[model samples]
Target: MAQTISVAGLRKNYGDVRAVDGVSFEVDQGEFFGILGPNGAGKTTTLEIIEGLREADEGTVAVLGLPPWPRNSRLLPRIGVQLQASSFFERLTAREQLQTFGSLYGVPAKKADAMIETVGLTDKADVRVEKLSGGQAQRLSIACALVHDPELVFLDEPTAALDPQARRNLWDLLREINTAGRTIVLTTHYMDEAEILCDRVAIMDRGKILRLGPPASLVRGLDAPTRVSVASGVLAEDEAKDLPGADEVSDDDVSLTISTRDPSAVVAALSARDALDGVQIRGATLEDVFLDLTGREYRA
Candidate 1:
């Protein structure tokens, strides 16, 4: 596949704080690329620079083989954007909003309605923008971005503030959109969302990308031990140490956390003694890998 976007030695500074420092990455054509990080991690700054909304202090950014800076006229029509919050005419109906946005791109009103249907807001097509719920508003924002049928889309925290069900619904819509062949670059603080949606993700912090790869590959490279939690610490230190495949155990009298690569062996040891109540075992995850690197998990 061809490269859709590329950033090299990207740097941005705000007085004393280096917002984006020496970052570089390439997004493949038609790939669902994600930037995952905690708040204040320079994710938005990096994205804005690539979107041509903000100029970097230094470095190079290219989208579709054109410089994104200065907001190139030739490039704008090929790019779509959905920010964390999108503003629209309060009195305009959902369908009307799309038509208005499409007009800027020379897209006809009929095309606008088709885009609205594409985002699944046809039922509320005539509803005013203000009357729409949070999820509905988000769907409308996506429709507006897609009104021109742009080749690449940038979504900043698209599912933020939505309930679980609404978030899942948006996820389904996003998958459908990607399946139709539009490349998507998404920035999200939710690790699970990135893991599920992104073909590859760049984990960033303090203006730097610490890791870049598939979520499964990143987790697998950790070489970290599996974690097992039990309801109570019934086994003594000596006993737990002798259990098959048990590497480490932290017992607090009220709960037990065992670290081991062979979870089944440890579970078998616990269950054989009728001490398996509330037992839970988990392998390493993206969050765990992040915690190991930064000593903190991704923020909301």
Candidate 2:
């Protein structure tokens, strides 16, 4: 794939606070790349610099092989950005909103209808923005961002506050968009979203990129302990710990949690138990990797 965006040793500081420090990564064409991090992790700052909204203090930055900062008007027309919260003319219809935004980039205003349809907002195309539901409005915001059909799209927390079903719907739409060849750079704290949508992810904290790779690989690479939970009917924590491959065990009156990498052995050992209710087994996940690397959980 062609390189769509590139940054080397990128740094941005506000007074003494290093919002983005020594960050570097490359986004390939048509790749769904994600930046995963907690609040104040500089994900937004790095995105802003790459989107040409802010200048980096140091480092080389490029988008489509051109400088994205210094107000590159030529590049602006080729990039789309959906900020954390996109504002629209409250009274304007969805289609009209896209028309206005497209006009800003000198693109054909008629494409607004096409974009509205692309984002699944065709049913609400003529409805006032304020009258739309949260999900509908968010889709409209994306429609406006994509009105120009830009090659590179930057999305900051696209589904931040949406309910589960709405978030899933947006995820499907985004996957469709990416499959159609748009390079998407997303910044979100949702591990599941990143794992499902991103071809590659960069876990960030303290204004730096801590780890970068495919989601499954990052989790597997961390070598996080596997866990098996059992509802204790008569077996005690001591017996559970003494089972084969049981590395660490914790117990309560109702359940036992065994943390280990070799779950097969543990499961085999538990087969002889007569009082066990059932077993729930799970492997390490992106959350585990995040915690292991950063020593903290991802907080939105």
Question: Judged by lDDT, which candidate is best?
Answer: 1
> What's the TM-score of each model vs. the native?
0.91, 0.94
**For residues 1-300, what per-residue lDDT tens digits would candidate 2 score against the true structure?**
789999999999999999998999999999999998888989999999999999899999999999988979989889999999889976789888889998987778767778888899888888999998888888888887788889999999999989999999999999998999999999997999999999999999989999999998998888778888888655777788789898999887667889998988888788777544678888988878877767764466
Evaluated against the true structure, the overall lDDT of model 1 is 0.90
| RMSD, one per candidate, in order | 2.4, 1.9
Q: Write the per-residue lDDT of candidate 1 for residues 211-254, one digit (tens) a residue.
A: 99999999999988988778765667677778898999888877
Q: How close to the true structure is residue 296 of candidate 1, measured as C-alpha lDDT?
A: 62
Candidate 2: pairs in clash: none
Q: Which ten residues in a row have the lowest lDDT in candidate 2?
A: 291-300
Off by over 4 Å in 1: 230-242, 250-256, 274-279, 297-300
Error of 1 at 202 (Å): 0.7
